[model samples]
Target: MQYSDKYLAFMGRAPKKIPHWEHWSNPDAETYLTGIDYYEHPRLCRLKLSQLYPQLELPIPEKDDPKPRPKLDLKGQSSNVDEHGGHHVRWGDTETTQWDWGKHFKDAEDVFAFSPLAQGDFTDIPVVESRDYSDEEKLYQEYRKMYPKEWGDKAPKGSTASVSFYNTMFMWPLLTFGWELFLETCLDPRFERIMTEFAEINRRVFRVFSRLPVNFVICHDDIVTSRGPTCSPKWMHKYIFPCYEEFWSIVKAAGKEVIFMSDGNMDAYVNDIMACGARGIISEPYTDYKKIARRYKDCFLAGEGDNRILYRSNPDEIRAMVESMVETSRITGGYMMCIGNHIPWNIPPKAVKYYLDISAELAHR
Candidate 1:
C-alpha cells in the first residue's frame, strides 16, 4: 500500500517531493489563475486551482455555494464593522461575517461571575460547539459520529483521522469574555476559578477526543501576538502549559499526536509547547522555523513561507523564500510548504503563481 504524502510527512519520512498544506483564501487570485469568475463558478475555480497546483488541497463544492452565514444570531452587534452592515470589499468579495466578541458580558464583574460549565452551550462563541459535554460517553458518541462508517475506531491505513479544537486553553477565556475583560480579570485571584472551570470543560473535550477514531488533534490557541507571548512565561506556566500537558497527555496516551497551532511569533514558547507533548507546531511566519528545525530534528513544522514575500510580487524574493523553506525541509523531514500568514483576498495573483511555481520546482528533499 502506498502511503499518502501527508501521512508520510506527518510521520517524518521526508517524501522526495515535499507536500503543501497551505492556508489559502485569495478568491481573486484563483479567478485570475483559472480565468473563471469565483463568485459565479466557485467549484470550477477551485477544481482548476487544484489541477494547476496538484499539491494544494482545495475543497470543491458540490454546487454553487452561497456566502457563509454567521453561526450565531448576534442580533446585529459585532466587533467587526463588516458584520454591522459595513461593507469592506477586497478582491471581489466583502469581508466575511465575524462572530460577536464579548457581547455576552457587560463588565469584568460579569466575566468573573461566568461559569463555563454552568453555561455549557457555547454556540454563541466563535468556533466552538453548541452541545453540552457534561457527560463524557455522550460527548464521545456525538464526536464519533463525525467520522466515516468504514473507519470504526481506527483510522484507515495511509489516511489520517483528525479533529481540531479552536478554543484551546488560552482561547476559552479570550473568546468567552473578549480580550479586554480577559486581560483585566486574568491577573486577579478570582480568575483562577474561571480558568479551572474552563479546564474542566476541556477535560470533557479532550476525554471525548481520546476515545475518537483520530490519529491527531490540532489544538489551536493564539497564545501569542505577532510580537510574542500575550501572557508572560510565568503566567503561561501557571494556567496554559499545565492544561496543555494534561489534555494532550490524554490524547497522547490513546496514540493520537498533538499538533499545536497558534498565530504570531512562537519563538518564546516553542520549547515550552514541545515539553507539553506536542509532536509538532504549525504557526505563522513570524516564528523562527530554522530554530525549531535545528532543535527538534524531523519533528513536523511549517509556516516558514510568508505571504508578505508573495504579496511584494518580486520573483527573486519569492524564489529566495521558497529556497529558504526548502533548506528548512532538509533539516526536518516533516516540513510542509505553507504560506503561514495566509493568502488573503488582496494578495497579487501573479505573485502567488510565481511562489507556487518556484515551490513546485525546488520544494524537494
Candidate 2:
C-alpha cells in the first residue's frame, strides 16, 4: 500500500503544478511505489537483478523467498485454463507475460478452431452466440481456485507488486470472447445486444469482485491499435462506452481508484476515460502524455517513459527523452514511469539501465 495514498491523493485531487521537486526526490516518494511491466524481457525483472545494482529503486519481487510454492495448475484442463476454459501460459518463461488471446480465442466456437479472429467471416458476432447464465457462472473460476494470492485471511502483511489487487474484471469479458470478436461485434449492427450479454457476464464476475479488499484496480482493455481504434469511434461511443461505464461503476461505487489501462494511440479516449470515472490513466507512449499530464492535472498519468527512444536513440536522445518525460510527470504531479508496450527482448539492456538511471536521478532531484 506504499504511495497508494499519494497516487490516490494526486488523482483524487491533483493540483496544477508540483512546484517542489523535493517531494518527488523523497526516497519515500509515492512514485517509487508504482511499478508496471508486461513483458518477457529480462531487464524488466529488477528485483532479480537488484542485488547486483543496489543503488537503484528497482522493482522488488513480491516473494521474499526464491523457493517455489506448490505449483498450482494455474492453467487448467487445457494447461492452465481459466473459468472460461481459456489456456493461460507464460511467454518464454518470463515473469511478465501471460500468453492467452494472442495465442487463441478461448471459448470461441470450434469453427474458429484456433484460427485468428481476423481469419473468420461472420455477419453477426464473430464469437459464438452470446450467453447470460446465472450468478453461479464463474469467469476466472480456475484462476481463483488455483492461485489466490493475498486473498482473505491469506493477505500478505507487507509489500507486494505495485498493484495490490490482481483483477481482470473488465478485461475478463473482453477475453471471454476476445479482442477480434469484441471488435467485430462492436462494429456489427447487433452491437448493443452482444455487448449487453458481455456486460451481463461481467456483472456476475464483479458481484464476486465486490467482496475483495482492493483499493487499486486496473481495468485492462486495449481497445486501440497503432493506427487508431480497432473498433470505430462511433461504435465505441454507443456500445463500448456503456460497457466501460457499467464495468467501472462498480469500482467507483466501492471507493476504489480506477486505473484504466490501455495500449495504443488512445488519446481520443482520455477525456472519455476520465469522464467514465478513472482516477488514473495507465497508458503507453503512443498516447499523448504531455497533453494528458498538462490538461488532466487531477488524474494520475502513467507510462510515458517511451522505450522506443531508448531502443534506438543515442545517449543524448535518451537523456532528453527521460528529462522531458520526467519533467512533464513532475509538472503533472501524479505520474508513474513505464516503457512503451513491453521491453522487447531486442532492447539493449544498457538502454534500460540508462532509462532507469535517469529516472532515479529525476526521482532523487
Candidate 2, 25-115: lDDT as tens digits: 1111111222413222224344544554343344554544333211221332213555876555432222222433423444334323332
Runs of candidate 1 exceeding 4 Å displacement = 65-92, 127-130
Cα lDDT listed for each candidate: 0.84, 0.51
How would you encode candidate 1's per-residue C-alpha lDDT over 1-365 as one tens digit per residue? 98887887887789888999888877768888889878788888788888888787888888877544232212332224444575433322444444456877889889878888887767555535556656778778878999997787877766767999988899988877888888999999999999999899899999889888889899999999899999999999999999999999999999898999999999999999999999899999999999998999789998888888888899999999999999999999988988989887668899988888888899888
lDDT of 1: 0.84
TM-score of each: 0.91, 0.63
> Which candidate has the top score in lDDT?
1
RMSD of 2: 10.7
- Worst ten in a row by lDDT for model 2: 21-30
lDDT of 2 at 328: 67
